[model samples]
Target: MSDQPPYTWWPAGLRRAGAALGVLGVQWYNAARTNIGATATSTVFEPFVTTALAGAAYARPFVRFAGTGTWTLGRAHFAVGDRSAELLAGASPPGEGTYGYTVTRYTNEAHKGNGLYRDLTLELVEVTNAAG
Candidate 1:
């Protein structure tokens, strides 16, 4: 009963808000990911490592393969400044075992930098539980 386009049927404010939220989330992910996505590019490949700890003391370590000798995170480790490579406890709801994940490395030649954000599919992979 409306002549307006299907896409325009939604409220303008709602659409804008959704897009804004999406962008904000991206920025946050990049910030957190910077911790590991820093050495994305260099003559010698630098292995980016990330350890997951519930608290502070003893904890399990999770290693990630950043890039190869030819392709590194040197200039492409900026796209995920705030993105978090590890999944929070809340996100997993407490678990253990080997998990699978897909790490997405972001790159930007214009900014002269690059970034990466990993997305875990299998979820939690608890190797050893430390009573710390």
Candidate 2:
């Protein structure tokens, strides 16, 4: 390993940069055998912006999270958009009590946003069935 000096984006800088992207975000749980992680069971979320899928716009809902670092994978999740007005947790929104999307795919997207994209883009697709 070559000796080098640490710079801004080494660690703390990343967290600071992440704050800017914390405009609209999503919250979810790990939904795994080991119910342990960043926000262990109560409620955890990450900064993200929802986008309409390019071609399959209606069919697919696209969400963009951090470009890099600490990605928690879970079967179930809740999305609260609309200026954090609507909240749906685990296949149900408020009184609905049952209805959500299954995470079919989680992808890492790369584009010319190192300055803005931070690290990369995270794309998640939801399925018909409920996930949790």
Candidate 3:
């Protein structure tokens, strides 16, 4: 008496197609390289907190991009998911170092297993206003 059905894992593989929407699909933009907004559906909570803590000082902005991107990361890059380049609050700065951002942490946190998909999280670091 096998508890398995006719197809055990077949139902789970269907989600990969929808998940890999940006394998060869989307192109992440690099501002310093070309001056455009792009990349994954990344998060920016820490940056926000940092900025908020600064109150009214001088702190650089942080950007986030997360989603499914087949775009390769150079020394710097992002993971984006659409054709139209949309800019975030403090993204695509005028120049690097003037107010630059970097990936402080990157993690492949989870896998849906519902498809050919894997979950990822990347933490970005940036300057924010000072308490003084």
> Is candidate 1 or 2 superior in TM-score?
2
Residue-level lDDT of model 3, residues 8-92, one tens digit each, is 0010111223333211111222323232322222222211111012122211222222464443332222222221122233344
lDDT at position 47, candidate 2: 23
TM-score of 3: 0.24
| TM values, all candidates | 0.14, 0.23, 0.24
lDDT of 2 at 39: 14
Candidate 2 ranges with C-alpha deviation above 4 Å: 1-96, 115-132
Q: Score candidate 1 by lDDT.
A: 0.23
Model 2 deviation from the true structure expressed as Cα RMSD, one decimal place: 17.1
lDDT of 2: 0.28
User: How far in Å is the alpha carbon of 15 misplaced in model 1?
Assistant: 37
Global lDDT of each candidate: 0.23, 0.28, 0.28
